[model samples]
Target: MFKYRWVFIIVPFLMFLEGCRENFDYRDASGELLFSKDTVYLDTVFNSLSSSTYSFKVYNTSNDDIRIPSVYLKAGADSGFRLNVNGNSGQAFSDVEISANDSIFVFVESTFDLDTLSSPSFLATDAVVFGNIDTQQEVALVTLVRDAIFLFPQRENGITESLPIGVDENGEPVSIEGFVLQDDQLTFTNNRPYVIYGYAAVPAGKVLEIQEGSRVYFHEASGILVQQGASLHVLGSKSNDTEVMEKEVIFEGDRLEPEFSDIPGQWGTIWLAAGSTNNRLEHLTVKNAVIGLFAEGDPQLTPPKTTIVNSRFLNSANINILARNTSFYARNTIAGSAGQVSVFLAEGGNYELLHCTIANFWNQGPRSLPALLISNYTETSFGERSTSPLTKAQFTNNIISGNAGIEMLFDRDEQEAFNILFRNSILQFDTNNSDLLQNPLYDFTDGNIYEEILLNSDPEFVRDAPDPFQLSSSSPAINIGTADFISEAREDILGNLRDQTPDAGAYEFQGN
Candidate 1:
């Protein structure tokens, strides 16, 4: 009788505890619901495309735990917006509970079909109404809908569209989700932003031209591939005002959220493949790519048939440029922060970089490679090694630096020519290491190779300036560049004139 009595009391107590946890004595959420954001502004999304997920916090400021009677979108089921509350995604939620002084999250996203709407508006607006008319509390959701030229691969019977790049190491045909550009689509103008879902190839014998003020947005793993005999020309005229980049062409990831702005490795490279001829990129800005630009092999023996001027390649997750036995020329260009080498000229070829900055202050991860690397040989995966002559690696009025001692490396095959020169530049060649003293590569006193180089010195990129490439008044890179060889890029990246005594790097020290 005593044991049965104890069991009866215990069972009732357990039921009451369980009720308090799930169905507690909850008060109706009234005037005490605090919200993290009154308005949740989503990223600019293209027509018929879902946007980045945005979230807001809903807090219960009351002393007693409360339950909201209803949480729903104002338009009910007729809205394009979607909401998720407490792991449930729907148009409306009921009995949403929040602990006293605790908070819960509400996520919002949208995919608006502006093409089908009777009255398509640029700004899409909706509100999440909480409870009935008597206890109404709401938060506004705003989204910017943009009309873009959506270029994506098509789906066939079983396979999506693809482009043939080359043969793999196993001698199998290698292809990716991509498509070759048609004759009519050879030119990308400044009218609408281009949103590419896969690699867009410029077929052989076709020329792809990008006019000024055009924005090219890439989805994951998407890029531009200039095939052999195809040329890519980006013509961005200089702007009078330095504050705005209205005249420059931009290539970046499609995510327009502020948090994703500087994140690297969002897309693939703008690859200028082997035998591609006469490619030019001027007054352009490339951001957040696996590799900003890659030029491989020469169409002919003429070095510097491809050129980049007054351009900026920034925050590449991999090498900013990896040129394999290719001839290249760049002036007033910036190869900024990267996870690996900024400019890697492997299986080397002729290269000239005038008034360029290759600075890697990569804070993302461990960077084993140097800021600049020059190799005269390439070792294939099948244990085959081939050597190529590095005819010329000339750098004048350049700044090559990083956050390490050995930021420049030279790998020679002994028999190949490794012609190198640096004139009137700031180089980060820390000679403290014994290996540097013994190597012939760091012979800074040799006028035949290195002349007037501020070796192992600070460039004074302002006092802890956010942009490490920006020059301060006391920068050693200023008034040190030789203007003898400059022909077209007399104006820096900022449109500031590189005077007779030019400053190194892309910008010409516009001190206010």
Candidate 2:
């Protein structure tokens, strides 16, 4: 009798709970759907390149569960803007339901071909419609797209044309997706922005001259390879306005968005082949590359094969300037923010850096290397090593500072000729290392190498500025440079004349 009474009581309680449940049958309602933002700006992108995704919330604030029958783009089926309604990606979506007081995300992205943009940049706009007819609600979508010259390898018969770079370990031909630039094709003008898909190799005995104001953008793994007997002459003139870099020739990634402006390793590098010679860079700006300049070749010590004057290499992934058995004379140049090293002189090289700043504050990850590395040996993929004599490495009136305690590493092989000197420069050396202190390379008594060097001294660089290597007013680098470098780099990178007691690094510290 008790069991029967319990069973009757449980049945009534279950029926009572069912009566208080929410209504599961949702009805399609026609009403205004509120949005988190009225307009979604997807930032700027090059023509034919997709913009970053931007999202907005569609909130159903009313106490009624409704179905947005038609969530679509206003431009219909022929629109550049792509839409994703509640994780379903397409040009249009139907039956987008939202519960009461709940929200749904609508992601928007676009890639438009502005065959005839009125100006250099034009706005590409669209709207995401929520419903049909009188109950329509929308969030406008806009993006600025600029026209670019797209360059990629031509494909025929399922085989894409490629440029012959060198040989593999087995002496087989190694190539990259590119074409050998020769004759009239060598000259790159400022007519339009060039976007490179693969490595553009300069033919032997040819010259690839990039004219002033030319902007050359590289895609993934794309760069310029200077071959033997070839030259890369970047003849960019200084801008009249010192504040902005307008007239300089720029070589960077193809991304135009502001977020990728300073990010590193967007593309490959300006690779100088082992026998390439007579390369010059003036008033050039290279940023966001794996290696800004990977040079290995004739170490012309006297005249210096490669001259980098009034140029900047910023935010490189590996090494800003990696010279192996090559020679470089960088005057009034800045190489900073590298993952490995700002300037890596490996397998021997003749390097003369005057009035330059080499800093690597790699806040992106844990950097294990220094800002500068000078070595007399390099290894191959098979661990086979090769050696060369470091003829000379001179750093005058420069700054080498980074997050690493020892901002410079000198891996000198006693068998090879290792000659290096740092005069009138602020360094980040730690004298506490007994092994380094005892090494002849760090022997300060030999005035020939470590002359007038300010070890472990802070240059007091300007923080949160575009050029983080710029000297602050009360910097130890002020009025500490030697006058010997004036004949080589009289003017700073910005055309500021260095005085007798000039400040160190690329920028001359001007007192406020």
Candidate 3:
């Protein structure tokens, strides 16, 4: 009887070991389906016709070994788009294998048009709906588009060309490249989107002026870095603003979440290095940068000045403007949501904010993360004694709102200290409305120094104000400016004269 029982148990155990070595069970695969991007905006330049490229990764999430002979990509009910891989034919994809939790990526370049709206088609019809026996899956893509368009007017050079010039086999500018730009001052008559991949350096020895209504685009890890001693004059109006749009403009390669440090210093920064003095930036919008403008150079007694008038700094990881011994006269500038501090000055530099709006800095709580700090220190010696030899900043007449952690913190030591002068600025404590969580009027260490003059009320904004930051006629910021403190050529971001008695923060109320 004992011998018979052992034989039965041993035979079953041998059978179970054989089953464990077999292929993965088809019913056990379960992976979530997700799309690469949430929104896709179609610019009107292409006339409702567009094509983008993308890649898809399929993963197997089960304990058993699974097989995917072929994978099929289908968009919409009628199979509007398809992908062919390595000379294999299959409406149902195959030629694959997966062990428990393995995956595969399928690269696809799909073209779709919105010519028929009533019969409306999907931007990305159901991708990867067919084929594949096991494991839940997902699809992702890499979008592609044209970067630039050139337009030329009829001149003595006998040239007449428009935007969207067809490209030749080499993907170079076919029409505009040959036109000889004889005049030192030339105009690009084109009105289309021009994409910039790497550093788009303009011509040397001549000023490059972009007319209003011109749109420029930049790819990932790319930006416009004006070298030392260069000038860029951007002419834009509210109605027809000259736009510089960047899709994947990443300044530092270290901040892409879920996949940190994919490419360190993959792209250089927008360096407005020394000799970039007296350059004016007006009515421009800069987005998605590691550091918006990192200006550095030796200081002069009558220092070099860079003025940012009526421009915006949005969605950057580091300082919007990092000046080292460079003086900046920023007026009516709007800064929104910095991963670190909005403005960082170092080593005997000066910055003046007149009628400017700084919102949403250090939106994330300060816990080892970069807070919205204005410092006179370097990266290596941060939180330590101040090695920076500079006077305090002059933050006069500005509206600073929406900071999560420490709002405007100043750091320095006795021999190397920096102070803040908020003569007539409104520091609205609107973060969560819980006055306790809001940043203090002044966040200064025992050895630091600063000053502020807070009015007892919020400066009421006017109805449908031109800028959301404008002060109403009845607000407290009107007729409260200090003329002696501001710069002589100081102008608001809107090009308005800064002449309030005790200047209200960052704007000159129209009626007042």
Candidate 4:
């Protein structure tokens, strides 16, 4: 009987200790809640589209545990924003608990149709309010919404058809149906930015003209295709030379988020199909694409397949210009920052690049290819190899440099006619490598063919800053180009007049 009495007393004492541990202080008047940020800025999004989730932390600075009676958006359901408190999502959440000296996260996302709003371009703002406290803490939400013409592939029965490849040998249209721009849609103006979805094809015997100051934005895997007998003319003038950013035609990915601005392979290539002719791109900027330009042409045509002057192809995931058995002329063109070769001439044909810059300083990832690759033979996917005669491949007054030890590769077949000339050019070749030095293909002493070639010298490229690919005052490529080669296009890429003895690269060095 004495032991039973002691047991009952001990049991009651244990119960008292449990009660003290379970007791949590819930203070409503204390203002001890802190936030990670006062405002969270979402990336720029298109109307009627949903934005990625943004988050913030709500800290409990007080020593005691607190229960937020209500956490709601000030704009409520009418606002374009949505909030997720802790693990629950709603306009208003109840009893959000935060332990003492601990914190909880709150997520935010937005989806709104700008057409229903007052203006196409507007700032959407909302506030998250924490109630039940004498002093409430709020976090602001802000987003910039833009209105764009979203062009996507046509869907039939919830299935997107594939793009048409080309016509077969029988002249019958091949492949699946695709979005083709009509005659009336050939002209694109600067009234608004165009956002393409899948490939936008220009039909045969048609012409697609992009006016000056037009901005063409392509979605993932989207690009422009000029079919056989079709042409694409970008008519951007130099009237606003002082403001090149506003006057030049721009082609890039559709994502306006800051994180995706410089990402490559966001879009496909501007493919100029076989037999396509009379394509011209002037005073333009093409960036962040798989292949900036893929041109194939018929050697029978006397005129060049394409002419690109005073244009820039920057940050391509693959080759900037992949020419396969084509004839083209480029003057004052800048092709730089590519994952693979900057200018790849495969199964080579007639090609001339005057005062052009072909560089690949790709810091995004590992690059194993050279900046310039010229080959007279090509291997198919099935291992079938074929060789074509290289009629004329000239690089005059050009700068071919990159991070790779050997920035230029020439794969020529002895049986084929490989006529290549590098006149008054700056080439970044690996001179230390005995194999490269002994190779006759890269022999700088061949003055009969490779005349006035500057090898392995630093061009002093202004890589980081206001204008990249420009030559600094201490560049060795200054005043080294042949005057006759630069006379074709007297103006540089930046509209600066080239002197009688111009520089090697696309830009004329303004020495101090």
Candidate of highest lDDT:
1
Question: After TM-score superposition, what is the CA distance of residue 320 in candidate 1 from its true location, in Å?
Answer: 0.2
lDDT of 1 by residue, 1-512 (tens): 99999999999999989887767588778756889999999988888888888899999877788999899999888887999997899889988989888999999989887775444348888999887678799999998887777788888898889988899878999998998888988898887788898999998888899999988999999999999899999987777875956888999999888899999999998999997898999888999999999999882356465899888898999988888899989988888889998889999788989889988888899998889999999888999889999989999889998888878899989988999999989999775778767888788888999988888778877627654578988888888888786666578876777678888777788774
lDDT of 1 at 13: 100
**What TM-score does structure 1 among the candidates reach?**
0.92
Model 2 global lDDT (CA atoms, 0 to 1): 0.86
Better model by TM-score, 1 or 2? 1
| Model 2: ten consecutive residues of lowest lDDT | 20-29
Misplaced by over 4 Å in model 2 are: 1-31, 93-95, 169-172, 182-184, 240-245, 379-385
Q: How well does candidate 3 score on lDDT at residue 146?
A: 29
Off by over 4 Å in 4: 1-25, 116-120, 132-134, 166-178, 237-245, 432-438
lDDT of 4: 0.85
Candidate 4 lDDT for residue 312: 90
> Each candidate: what lDDT?
0.86, 0.86, 0.51, 0.85
Model 4 / residue 138 / CA error / Å: 2.0
Q: Residue 387 error for model 2, in Å?
A: 2.5
lDDT against true structure, model 3: 0.51
In terms of lDDT, the poorest run of 10 residues in model 3 is: 247-256
Tens-digit lDDT track of model 3 for 1-512: 99999999999999998787664454332334233433322222222223343444455565566555445654433543445443343335654555566655544444444355333223344455523446545343322222234222334566442222246645776432122222443343224344444454433344456666555544455555444556566665453233633211122321223233322223334556566555566676665667777776644424345777777766566656667866777766777666665666766566677766665535344423232355555544234433565554666666665534335544444565455566556564323435433434343221233334453245565526645556777877676556765575366555566653645655676672
Q: What TM value does model 3 have? A: 0.54
lDDT of 4 at 126: 90
Order of candidate numbers by TM-score, starting with the best: 1, 4, 2, 3
